[model samples]
Target: MEETRVLLRNKDVANMVDVAVSMEHGGYVGLRNALLMDGAQVIETLRDSGLRGRGGAGFPTWMKIKFAYDAGGTSKVVVCNADEGEPGTSKDRILLSTDPHSIFEGMAIVGKAIGAGRGFIYLRAEYSYLFPILENALDSARKSGILGKNILGSDFSFDIEMRSGAGAYVCGEETALFESIEGKRGEPRTRPPYPGTYGLFGLPTVLNNVETLANIGPIFANGVDWFRSIGSENSPGTKLFTVTGNVHRRGVFEFPMGTNLKDIIYEVCGGIAGGKELLAVQTGGASGAIIRPSQIDIPLDIDHVASSGGRLGCGTIFVIDDSNCVLDIVKNTLEFFTNESCGKCIPCREGGVQLLKLIKKISEGRGSVIDIDTMMDLSNTMRETALCGLGHSTPVPVLTSIANFRDSYDRHLDKDPCSKCSPERGLK
Candidate 1:
């Protein structure tokens, strides 16, 4: 199916980087509309819209605004999480590099709604090339009277600053992003003081990723009813999927929420790269569930993926063909998490290395059946006890691969292995 473009807009328009081009296409319409409503009214409008965060969390957008709004602080903050660090995910970068004005507009609207005076866009270090593009967009917006003091000539004054991360994957986590923005080491913080109540500089903050913020401009531009009518009942509005890995057409595509995974793979992605037999599919991120082909028919929405034992996190899809072994693929995922772990907590710091060791053992044709069972036990413990999502979710791919593709693991137990199982090129 063709992309149902709502968020990805006006690629054909010349000089899209210029504010005038964005204005030509009804840009800042949402901010103009939002500025008219009271903070509580804005929150209620979002509630009626049924918008959830496009980030991995799948949290209700309205609720986040309400939390920061109801936190009842004069000095609140709005954060745009542009740190798109998840493996196989590039949707945020696509939005920021192409449609940057909308992001700034969204942040300004949130600042007005929550009574925030200043906002920050935490751009990932890997995306430093985008800094100038974003800055150019910001300068254009400010000059056009869309940002800076008294936006659009209103008394409400708000401005946004851009911050760059230092290439830490853990900074993708909300709290870690805040820490990095504060000139500290990027590491996840303890809960009970969530971003809504106690956030950046100890101010009540509303934090949403780039795609989630981008949706705000469109939702108000076209009525909320239009957004709600497009996607599933629970998950309203279009979703951005970054399709990569062994696909004939690998890029960002937008589809309504609840689009069938089978259709996404077979049609949207143009089947596998070379008509190869599809072996497995990994959704969400590197640590997302390893879904078997038989399970691909299910809807690709937050609730559906959760109910079906997967995560629709960041809307990334990694397509694996028959040539690669599941064990090797999972080993690579574990290795990434092992390297990315902040080492602040014991379970994740120690468990990652231990999990990597076990996967290496199993992939090298050195394991018995007991090793499989042992890995599961260790993964469960980490999931339940880890300090944050990094530790909790690190084991998802391993556990999901074990549950869905047990035969792959069993094959490694045999002395004679298939061509797909190679120990030398364990992880790439």
Candidate 2:
């Protein structure tokens, strides 16, 4: 049987290509039937599917659910982390805006599997346009008996509310999100008690990314074998990539996990917005490492990207052309991390600022050999000492930039300026 192709736009053609048709075409009806029969069966199907988390770490989703289920709690909470603060990443917004119903259904299925009473969709404030759509979908699902008391006529009850994040990037982290939802300042907490054990007001909580939860409805509608057959053995199912930067057809695309990076850039996105040659592609957002064109032909799945010293961080692809300055871009990225650093930790709070200064100095032709050494030194310390992912991954782009674009920095040090940053010489 051929694999099913699902996209946000598929909902727009709901008259012809409905979710049922898509799931049936993809061999997912069995899972859906199993879910309707009993929630325990859905858990078994998910365990068989081997679906891991897609947000970043790629932890097993089933295990996360099992942990929450065994937490011995009556008031468990399900949270969908829609706060996508990663720069150059908009795929979550796309999913929320277009295929919200899928997410809603997924949340419902999860609430059933874990015996949860309430669920929350924590979306970023930037996605204000999607607020009405999500609210309307939840309201519609409730009225139609798809949500609210006794979802699908089962004893399981769930009510979903959409919560807007007030522009905090750290809130993307699960523990911080918990604090934010409680009307407290968003800051990551120390963990021995992971969210699965103790979260969301000291209750067992299962928090998943928007894209991760979006896959749930399809998983229930389709069987484990069907989902396993689509992607790689470890990273199964279709993953969404928000293709941006210099790409002609720059937008969100959903493809199987092992799709070629070259195809995503050249074939799917029409090759870098023009006839310009591809220099590097940012596989993730600011925290992602850059892959040179020589590495473009490599598969775009998590394991493959990791093998190539890159990550499928949120699957945000940025195609960089020769006209752009890698140094400037890296500096800007550092500046973002620096400005957005919640200042909760001394390492991230201070290190991000220091790295940005060095990058800016290099980009402005004011850096010396010592500056590069200083940047590397601080990056090493930050990587080791930082308290959160922000500090841990902050230096990824900086280090990758120096590795791939050493010559750019060298040229600036040699008192030669690139066309992009030659403004110090005042050229028109």
Candidate 3:
């Protein structure tokens, strides 16, 4: 119902901007506790904590660590995926801005977990403005003995470096991010050798999302049960959701996993803007599934959303109201995907163009039910066979829009009279 802040707990600590000030308020305590344990024990504590990745997919944090840990590369690395490029998702940026040390500490703990001496943060170009804040945090941590040579009086020496993205949305994908960091054109690499096995600079790397890494510090600072006690049985810990669109209070919220989407819209975000009726809510961002008002009652967790044929990807919740046509909004969304597509693969390269054209036809009153079916086929093809997640997720909105707003698409069968988007008339 309300924010159950964990990574955001630094907000309650005064002057958390300074690393020394942050330490006084219990920052880096996790890394300190983690350093006391061997690498295996550090990971075992994480396993007991029940932490999952906060970035879209919700993979288990401990398992991913174990993969790279067991890979036993001579030169292992830890990467913080700060490339928060998904539309309407700024939760990672919030953690980076408010309590950067937590992020730094988390990376360091992961570094120790995998016996990595160096860490890298692939920062989103849009978030380049936060560069100095991040630099200051790293510098402060280095000086405070929280990072760098023999951290916290242990042999686990770890330091973090930050890299700026080239404003490519595809770079948010782990492999693409690795390619960009290694001085290559940002494009998705084929799988089989996932990032954990072969990552940045050809080293076995444990790559984690910004929000996912942020949870690491608190997991060790507090006990396993403490973190596990917060959220659902399977989906433990809190989730940071960025609410936008027709919501009156549009911002990031940290609710326990499995928080109700309806409460988030009505109680947490003050419902739809004005008194307009809620038409749809798109979770996971522009690339997320579109949900009808009835489905908004679903829990905002990994398993629940997936079981309900949706995803809590990146945990961005976008609400739509009666004043806007669903076709109009989905067309705008497709335009973004089409423009941002890397064009490396056929499905995303060509399919996205076709999707845009079809959605535009419907938006401009020139589409048919046949067009809807065609778009679904094209989108599904991209999802199943595309090179990376960019193509995979790009179809989610188009497919879900057609599913939940079939009546809206049916209205545009031969002609669309929904241009003005008046609350009472258009697409209602």
Which prediction has the highest TM-score against the true structure?
Answer: 1
Ranking by TM-score: 1, 3, 2
**CA RMSD for every model?**
1.5, 3.7, 2.9
Candidate 2 off by > 4 Å: 1-4, 7-9, 14-40, 416-418, 422-428
Query: Residue 333 of candidate 3: its Cα lDDT?
Result: 80
Question: How many angstroms is residue 172 displaced in model 2 relative to the true structure, after the best TM-score fit?
Answer: 1.4
Candidate 2 C-alpha lDDT tens digits along 1-428: 12235545354444221334333334223324644656566677778887877788777788888888888868898999999998878878877766667677677777778888899999899888778877877776677666688766667788899899979788898888899999999998888798878998888888998888878766666567778888888789888888889988887788888888898877887786667877787887888997677877977788888877788878888888988888767776777787778898899998888887777677677778889889888998999998888888898888877777777778887464456753332111
lDDT of each: 0.88, 0.77, 0.86
Q: Which stretches in model 1 have alpha-carbon errors above 4 Å? A: 414-418, 425-428
By TM-score, the better pick of 1 and 2 is 1
Query: Per-residue lDDT of 1-428 in model 3, one digit per residue for the tens?
Result: 55787878777666566898988878888888888888899989988888889877889988988989989557999999999998888899888888888888889999998899999999999888899888988888888888889988888788899899989898988999999999999998998797788889988899899888888888888899898898898999999999999989999989999999999989998888888998888888888889899999988899999988899989999899888888777777877888899899999989988887887767667778788889999988898999888899888888888888899888877774467432232221
Q: List residue ranges in candidate 3 displaced over 4 A.
A: 12-14, 420-428
Question: Lowest-lDDT window of 10 residues in candidate 2?
Answer: 15-24
Worst 10 residues of 1 by lDDT: 419-428
TM per prediction:
0.97, 0.91, 0.96
Error of 3 at 255 (Å): 1.1
Candidate 2 differs from the real structure by a C-alpha RMSD in angstroms, to one decimal, of 3.7
Q: Give the per-residue lDDT of model 1 (tens digit) for 1-428.
A: 87788888765566667888999987899999988888887888888889899989899999999889989668999999998999989999888877888899889888888999999999999999999888888888889888888889888888889999869899989998889999999999999798889999888999998999998888777878998998899999889999888888898899999999889988988898876889999999897999898999989899999999999998999999988888888888988999999999999999888888888888777788999998999999999999989999999998999999998899888455446655664332
